[model samples]
Target: MLTRTFLHFPQVGERRERALWRFGFCDWHAIVRSVAPSPWRHLWDEWQREAEASLEAYEVGNAAYFAMRLPKSAWWRAIPDFVHRAVFLDVETDGTHRITVLGIADSEGYRAFVRGQDNFDEARERLESAKMLVTYGGSHFDLPVLRANFPDWQLPPLHLDLCPLLRRLGLRGGLKAVERQVGLSRSPQTDGLNGWDAVHLWWRYVDGGDERALQTLLCYNREDVMPLPTLLALAYERLWAQTLKASQQTFLPMMGSKERRTG
Candidate 1:
């Protein structure tokens, strides 16, 4: 999908991309092979160069170049080895702009960056290094809070928000609630907890400097992100099925927990 996305090129938007599709330019390769030679051909030439470079980077197991064009897109399914390039992100805040804890998990491990307790730069570095970022509701909540929290540094180039895709699949609820439908659940300590509980836990740590409370907060936050890979894969499979809805096959197997595992 990333390879077929033309919106990454300059002067192209959703409308322009659709126009390209109508003009018989359906994929990146199609645009590159087009011989119409319009005035916008220069842009396509430049994009061809970048697109080839991105694919090459992905082929070499290096996401460095492709990561630069990371934005919300349906193209991820086409990008090879995308699971390893992704980092799932979630943040706990005070219902406003104050972020008390920022959690991100990838193949490396689950990481929690607490305010005043750990180095914020560490989390920033980890996120910046990731090629893609996945979030459940980051479009409205997590990403805004993170940007406000770190005005200087930029997040990963691409962000995949699961909220819309989940809604399309009839999975409508909070993160934990949606997880429940899919047999994903939190541990005993974090079970039945809500956002308010997280706030109280943070307050407990801030007031008494209780590391236990802090640890619990981290654990709660970790649950928010741990199941993202499976969720993302499930979303992709569903969306792909929709594209082939005309087919007689009515069911697509969901990605297994083992497949979602980073290790």
Candidate 2:
């Protein structure tokens, strides 16, 4: 999807991109090798340079380039390509919204950073090294709380916020609700737990010294991060179909997904 995208080209919005697709410039390489007459022909030379640079960036797994070029709503295009460098994240806050627990997971495993107990060096390293960040409401809630908590931490450049993305797919409401709507089931322990419950659980451990509460809270946070990969994969499959259909292009196995069929 990254190689197939034209969004990185300057002044090339979705309309122009679709126009290119209609003209059979299906990917960056096609544009680089084309001499087709079109409205943007004069810009092709410049676009070709940019496309080459973009392709190099993609090949080297430099996700920040696309993150800066592509619009936030279209960050899904970078997901399939950079998912190995991606991390799923969620933050828990106290009553006043002070971040208490920070949870992150990558291909390796999940780790939680508690406010006073855990040093943030590892979390900071993980986030800074990550190419993409997946979160439910990180844009409005988790991220803001994180910034307040760690004012100087460098975050991942590309963020795929599932709240608005899922909303675009007509799956409305919180993460758990959207999860169930998409046929994802939570574990029995964390099934119905919500943000308020997370806060209360933190207090239960913090104020009452309840070890079970802390363990349960950790489980809940892990559960929040666990389903993110599947959700993004599902969203990518649906959005890719929508993009191809909207551009009126023949299916071309863009991501090497066996599920995509020629039409």
Q: Which model scores highest in TM-score?
A: 2
Alpha-carbon TM-score of each model against the true structure: 0.72, 0.92
Model 1 C-alpha lDDT per residue in residues 145-238, reported as the tens digit of each score? 8889898876766677888778888999988889989888789998998889999888888889888988888898988888888888888777
| Local distance difference test, candidate 2 | 0.83
Off by over 4 Å in 2: 251-263
Question: Candidate 2 residues 1-263, lDDT tens each?
Answer: 66778887878899988888888887888877878577887897889899888767766777778888888878898776777788899998887769888999997789999888999899999998888889998899988888888889888889999888878888899989988898888888888999999999999999999989888888999889888888888788788888978888874444446422110
RMSD of each: 5.8, 3.5
Clashing pairs in 1: 1-75, 1-78, 2-75, 70-157, 70-158, 71-158
- Runs in model 1 deviating more than 4 A are 4-81, 246-263
Relative to the true structure, candidate 2 reaches a TM of: 0.92
